[model samples]
Target: MNSFEQLKEEAVRLDAADTLAPMRGEYLFPQHDGKDVLYFTGNSLGLQPKGVKQALLQECDDWARFGVEGHMLAERPWLSYHEQFAAPSARLVGALPHEVVVMNQLTVNLHLLLTTFYRPAGKRNKILFEQKPFPSDQYAFESHAQLHGLDPAEVLVELPYSEGRTYHTTEDIERAIEGMGDELALVCFGGVNYFTGQLFDMQRITAAAHAVGAYAGFDLAHAAGNALLHLHDWKVDFACWCSYKYLNSGPGGVSGIYIYEEHTRNASLPRLAGWWGHDKASRFQMKNGFVPIPTAESWQLSNAPIMSMAVHRVALDLFDRVGMAALRAKSEQLTDFLQRVLMTVRTETGWALEVLTPSDPAARGCQLSVVLPGKDRSFVKVLAEAGVVVDWREPNVIRLAPVPMYNRFMDVLELGQLLARFAE
Candidate 1:
């Protein structure tokens, strides 16, 4: 590793030794120019596994065959379809089965969770979050503040990194919470930053917020399958994630939420409820009294979208087979390999392509955010023309995520070669 080589032979050798390499075959890679495109955008949207179509078709067939009776008679029982995700989704985020539920989209769940947790009182009414949060989260934070009759400018605390730095240090976040003190109503952050790919210290941040009697939550849109999480052990107040990224459940896939055990079992906790959240025992009794389930499902506003959940079930099955620990191990190596590849290109091109994401493995996942400030932004177009699927941020940054799920070491090598040639 010290004498990192840029040869294709070396990449092939590395891939040969990667224990999780064979799992790549499980996914369906899109063809480009008579070959598979080198996909490095799992952080944006993951490639679909081959199993998804069959699972979706099975759900459709059952729905057609059983009419209304599929709720109880068909495979996986439509009435309790959301229950199937509890255990596997819990494992993905390190929560107990009762603590997790798959329902609604990411932003909707965020609003629902905020309504329950972000109860602002006089003085202790501020919401603290990252400065550059994903646009949806930023909107949710501001809207929730407005709903509570609090001015966002006055009550929303945006945590910024030190000057000239790209990401907030764990100490910066912890200190920011301490600085907010009694005024911090909630501490919300994207578990893995969408742009920087910097993994925040969720557990420490939760502990710091709790010390000041503030709620701690996360929008885990990028963190869900991209990083190893122990939300239950971390004692995080609540969290939510979409399954379309690293989980690979297709575009606009169903999202999931996790409520801490303390909150789930607490009947006193107030939440906006609906028929789906009503207790199953007396659900059909024609009773008016709303009885919320003593679990995360209590937040459900509607029934499960069976088709979306069916595809999600297939993705979760893969997670169960290939554990998060194994995935994280490969992810670190894959990302590190990419960093080296990019560095080699930088050396060859004499261009200052800076990686803004943290170098420490503990502080990141599979993504590497490369900033090409003075270079031609057209390099992204060139990479795209060459059939490498990566993402670009405005003002010049190309985000490449070498997903451990399907990306190969050879892909990284080829990308470096492409960049080196493009520079010429």
Candidate 2:
């Protein structure tokens, strides 16, 4: 029949053949009109894992049965609760277990790592990152500069994208790092940009930074679980990410961090220490000197938040089972299909919609940032009213992320059909 109908048939065939298609059943989606909504906001917040409630209840039951002793007696044991995350987290980011630690929220971990890594000296007092980073990161950069008694405007160098592009090229980024030369103390970037969904070349960027004598770090809030990463092999100096987004741990879930093994073993490295980071043998003794754990755990400021971490445990287990390789392979195909569908909508409806995210699959994750004609908010409202869950950024952009974990090919087809209808 019509092109939209043909697209629907193709979607159905693809869904039937998808190896990861059964994973759609593992999550709980928001309902509208007694049906699951067309959800494409996993880049903002992932769908809740179906097992989350049971996992949380287990911890609650343990707490009820054993009060203070639950620290050592709970099913997961609160004393070493965070240790469970190390192996899985390292696998997710491609690092050694000792280089990873589940800890505070994203910004808090960023600040803690900054305390140790953003060491300014003489001319080498600058931090380089992409333009328009997540607001929290921008603020952290400013405040960290202030903490060092330096002006943020002077200390922060934001690498601007080319005039016609929404994302920076790796070559451009490396060139900028070289241009900054000895002035750069650190080169920190979001492994994938939150706005454009651009996945930066972390390995090349890290090498470029090191070549210039600057440390390299990343905020993987959008990259973790969405992209294929190799932090240890890439020699990423440090990194941090939130669990609530791609990792799907729930709202305000505990965050995780990564530090290179060399940095972890540097006993003299500057850090804002807490008892939780003290050596396990002497930690309970409440010793005066802070003998930090010779691992990423040394950056921990407090014991694990059991309730929140329970959700994280369930989420990480899902990733461990399915693995990032499978997830990323599915992500590439799904995102490519979405792009084709968007192009079809544009062709049929004559809509001047601009997809701002990079076209190269390797340069992006699952999300696509689109700029509609007139940059109107009314269409976004229409989509929301129709039970389509997407994210809108200020000025003019709607971000849609069809997460490989649960989203289907049919979802993309439906979105294209809706866009055509609304445009008409």
Candidate 3:
């Protein structure tokens, strides 16, 4: 008989009208008792598609029946296995198939790209990244700098937040690039911040980095499969992402990397090579010298891990079938619905909710970082106990993402009602 009940009822009505609601059946949602938990933590680890197990089993069958012959004789053809995935994966990330390669984990690909693009020199040895980057990226950059005999403390620059704000503005990021232009070697940041869920201005950041002659890269662990991207058109020098998050390929799955066609063919760029990067023509010729392939495939260092690639291939195929445009349309609607109801709760309860993600749909993905004013971490615990799954960062921040394909408008409504109760 309260506003919370009214909101829940409205959400149920909206769910009945949602066209993408059926897509929820496509995933293997975790359940408690006899009901589906209102899951909103896909930004951390996405729920698996029902078909993934079948796809993975096919690969296992191929290996069992054919053994070593699976390389050329398997149904999916393990010899050129990654090729099967390249096109759809590239399509999802807005790159040409030749410009994208499925390779090692996210951090490893980052290290490899750093080898090629983080070309440090006398005055230009400094690397720039946003403040509060995910810990993995910070470690990769720091170690890469150390490998080049530079102190990360001195050579790595972390851009601070804007005036009276928790998130950095485009102008602030661009200004930092300009100030450090002369000394900047690489400009890199998360496409969508892991904790704050703030999506940076990739196009503007790329242009600004190039304006100062610095190479631009993105650690897209949180962005890939969560939002649409155009790395090739954006002229991003390199980018990397994990498959486990938005991509939903299971834990520690093979990650992907993008090196625009220009860099793919850049003969002068330094790379750490292995046999997998060797020319296919001479690959089996037992050649000694490394003759790199001309595409992003040349960046690969080892044979593709079949299990990881199988999972990603299935996930990518699903994305291809659904298509980014359709997914993004649903994403905007879902997140907009979440933002609206949460804002209403804040207004009614006199609770201050800080949304750190950009207001512009163009600048954010599915996530909205909700910073609860003067609330303890226990507040998040209460929501979790109420069967809501939102990620909590230290110091009173909760991140909720209503994934486009699987989350329902009703799920968003239910979470808001629970938070309103906790606020009381």
Candidate 4:
């Protein structure tokens, strides 16, 4: 067994060795009981970047200074606020700015994308998703299917892993596509499963969906910013993501959506319309007809929320400055170190604390989903009391995300020790 003092000493050494250690000061880490909490919940809610406060304050000051004219006169010009976030946001997802837009919430964006992509006909009407999809997504898909006069059970197909594991492999997903054949209207799943942190093969999945004559989409709420994505190059039909997690855009920040360039100019593509989606030139013309914008902007359902947009802008700026490659490098090393240390604990205690996340770093992200032997809830509470802030999902999983931008290597070390001590 690793000595408690030895673990603490090793944590200090790892912290000293971390190349990204200095960046931890850029975020506000929570403290409790006179100890800094080992925060591992970035997959649920990211630690706030220090700059977010100044960004939000700038908006408040703009509102105070310009009042009604803030839309045009504010420092950042609220009218073009969403556009300011586009470049960095596009880079984060490997898309052209015109292919991406920030608007609405995650589920709302999903519904809107479904409106454009889920065209059910006589045979090609089913939407296939992974079994145990996030509850919100399951609800959205079911409700959307019902709206088109199709029974949810008949139109919504959930593909479970043949091996009965926490994650569904690419082979299993591709088989589902082949089985569904021409009947599938859309194949959408989480880019990274929220419960297992399993990063699906987007390129392969998209190809399979297209081969089967189905639309390909991804819910990236847990994947965006946590993992590197090339959505446009992958020829994904559409994708939606919330910015509050690894994007560090604060709670309820603006979500992003991507529509492939092929779909961008397709005037025939059906979408639920709104004034904000009209072409900018004709938006205020107050004309009777809705002239959709030529780009992904056409998907917007309402005017931009400048407050949320400001937060997004700050987060994107940070990403642009730090760059994804550098963050991902640290992410791989940090998570690898974490898994190694945690495995040691499992070996010492003979605990069935298997990591649900894939062992291959390329097939996962910074998040590690630890599956405990018994009542995971009690284990979660013990970790909580030990000053670790990991999150618990139902059944037996506890997710701990060591976000690269702000989480220190020592944080991961502390987490492993805390859990090991709890098990003892």
Best by lDDT: 2
How does candidate 3 score on lDDT? 0.87
lDDT head-to-head 1 vs 4, winner: 1
lDDT of each: 0.90, 0.93, 0.87, 0.86
What tens-digit string does per-residue lDDT give for candidate 4 at 271-389? 99998889998787899888889999999979899888888887777778788888898899889878877887887666778898889888898888887776647777777787888
On the 0 to 100 scale, the lDDT of residue 125 in model 2 is 96
Q: For candidate 3, which ten residues in a row score worst on lDDT?
A: 1-10
Worst 10 residues of 2 by lDDT: 1-10
Model 3, span 161-228: residue lDDT tens: 86677788899999999999789999999999887788888989999999999999999998998888
TM-scores of all models? 0.97, 0.98, 0.96, 0.95
Ranking by lDDT: 2, 1, 3, 4
Clashing pairs in 4: none
Return the TM-score for candidate 3, rounded to 2 decimals: 0.96
lDDT for each residue of candidate 1 in 269-341, tens digit (9 for 90 to 100): 8789898988988888858978989999999989889999888999889888999999999899888888888
**Whole-model alpha-carbon lDDT for candidate 4:** 0.86
> Model 2: per-residue lDDT, tens digit, 295-407?
99999989889999999999999999999999999899999989889888988988878898899999999999988776566767799788798878877788999999999
